[model samples]
Target: MLIEVEDDFRSSSDKAYEKIFDMILTGQLKPGEKLIRRKLAEKTGVSTIPVMEALLRLEALGIVESIPYRGSRVVPITKEKVRDWYALREAIECQVMRIITRTLTEDEIADLEKLANKLDAMEQAGDTEGEEFWELHFEMHMIMARKTGHQSLIDSLHRINLFRLLQRAQYSATEHKNQIPKDNHHCLIDALRTRDPLIAEEVMREHIYHSDSMI
Candidate 1:
């Protein structure tokens, strides 16, 4: 039997966590917003304990900070995070692009194009409400990285994705002052489809660097 989780237990906390996580992701919860215990519990429809549990998890994820006897708050954005993530992402994505270009099959590239189309539709329809674009976007990166056949590197990158998402989301929400270039994503896939890892790496780095500038 597939056991369904109780809606009012620790699952409540998990549910609360997910809601809070999305709020942060979607820019609903701006940086430094205090997460009051009673308010969070009432807002999330979970108990205070579950809300605290949720906040604890966010803190562990480096997205939340606790205040003494008061409550937790979302961490404010810092340029250092943008700088650090740009350096880290450049290194990881460059190697991943090389791996992808070397061995990814034609069918794999086709699948990526399909994913890109979905993302394009989302972008065009303005459906990027929260994490709507994240799953597809992250998978696009992951598909290339996974082709490396380096499980350890892939695993490490997965851990790093939290911060990457944070930085990108923060940039999009709290820092962006203009529209993202519409053609950059398509151009990236074009480079990959042509089996040009050099251009592919360059485009990915450029995108990250561009995001850094906006942040």
Candidate 2:
């Protein structure tokens, strides 16, 4: 019975988290918006405890920020933060690309190419909401990062990815910018296929810089 109670709390927390996360991503919760536990609990049909737990989880993801003696709010994407994030992302991704180029098999390269094609179709279909576009974008990079066979590298990239999502959410909340080009992924895949680690690294650097310009 004790274990059952614990499971129930965990379930509620997870549900609250997913609900709140979707709300932020889908633009239901705007940037810099103050989050009230009671209101969120009411919105998610959960208790305040679970709502608080969900806010903590979102804070960990960089999607929400907490201030001492104040409260938690959705993280606002600023130009400074965007620049810092892209720089860190470039450094980590360039190294990951180098490692992937050295170890990626043809099958993996082909898979990435397939992802590029899908992204192209998504773009052409005018995914104005950007949810599908960013999901596929994250998927393609995650596949490349996983190919490195380095757990630490994968973990770092995942953390950075959370910030990327935050950035996208912020963008979606305000202006719709064509920051990431549909062809950029295709370019990176082509660079990997060249079998030159240097070329791949260079392309990855340029790809990340493009994101900086968009910000």
Candidate 3:
């Protein structure tokens, strides 16, 4: 009986965490917005315990910060922070490119090419800010990372919640539309096809810096 209750509590906490995480990523919960436990509990339709647990988890991930007496608030997005994330992403993903250059199968390359084409089409349509666009963008990157067969790299990216960082960067840099080339992802795939780690790393660096320049 106790184990079942524990499982129920864990399930509720996971749901609350996912809901709150999505809210943050989708910009429904803006940076610096205070998270009231009672309000979140009511919103998530869960008890305060689960909501609190979710907030604590987010806090650990650097997405939320608790003030001494002010409760918790979403971490504010800033150019400096975004740049830091960009640098971290570049470091991790450049290595991903280097590793996958030697190991990525032809089928994997084709899959990546398909996703790149979709991303290019979305860019041409000027639909970059939509949730669907960002989701696909995240998926594309995750596919590359997964192709490297590096669990640690995958976990690092997930731990940092790179998708949320990308969304926050995009939201903060609304003035920088059309800065990224529509063929950016296609170019990346071409670099990967070269099977030269150095070439792939250089392309990856340029790709990441394009987004970093926006902020």
Candidate 4:
């Protein structure tokens, strides 16, 4: 994520936690893959103690789990779990978009357009840097939610951001990802511009559904 802390706000364990979390969320570590703390320490250039600390945090977050006799591993993503998370995310995000549509300013619209264009540019370059795109795209959605002036909703969205990005990344190179990202952004922008809460919520709901299905 953003490692630009003026001071090191993250501890060694926190850094290890974030690294492992990133791998798990991006499907790099892969669901159900065993996490060997020693190997992870060597790979990440940290100590096994910190890796252990990180794994514990991950377990609490439901991103990793221990098998009692088999050590720990990344949690497998199940269809049911995806559906449940989407149900929660969609409900929260749609409400945020509805509020945003009624109160967004011209400057905010321009900022969103820039973020969407950046995602498009990254995709068009054939980099398939889904991780980069995923983070930025997630931030754009959070920005929209935050602009709604609801701290509670923003806090809720923060907790689900990584999980949602994991699901969204599954849409990359799917059977029909073409223009879906760009088009979704365009539709969202239009809704905001028109100050149409109905349209904004509808478009956001549809977009999230399509992305979730790809997962």
Worst 10 residues of 3 by lDDT: 1-10
Q: TM-scores, in order shown? A: 0.66, 0.82, 0.85, 0.73
Give each prediction's root-mean-square deviation over alpha carbons. 5.6, 5.2, 5.0, 3.8
Pairs with backbone N, CA or C atoms under 3 Å apart (clashes), candidate 3: none
| Total colliding residue pairs, candidate 4 | 0
The lDDT of each candidate is 0.72, 0.78, 0.80, 0.74
1-215 in candidate 1: lDDT tens per residue?
A: 11112365568888888888777766688787888878878878888988888899888767788878877898776887657766877788777876687677888888888887777666655666456577777777777778898886675566457665655555644324235566546666777877887877887788777766765
Better of 1 and 4 by TM-score: 4
Better of 2 and 4 by lDDT: 2
lDDT tens digits, residues 5-116, model 4? Answer: 1244548887788788777765678876999999899877789998998899777656678998999998766788778778888999999988988887899899898887
Segments of candidate 2 deviating more than 4 angstroms = 1-9, 120-130, 172-183
Point to the candidate with the largest lDDT.
3
Q: Kindly indicate the candidate among 3 and 4 with the higher TM-score.
A: 3
Candidate numbers sorted by lDDT from highest down: 3, 2, 4, 1
What global local distance difference test value does model 2 have?
0.78
Better of 1 and 3 by TM-score: 3
Worst 10 residues of 1 by lDDT: 1-10
Per-residue CA lDDT of model 3 for 1-215, tens digit only, reads: 00011144588898888888778766788888999999999989999999999999888778888999899998887767777777788889999999998888888899999999999898777778765786788789888888778898986666555445534643654566667687989999999899999999999999988877776
Name the regions of candidate 3 deviating beyond 4 angstroms.
1-9, 159-174
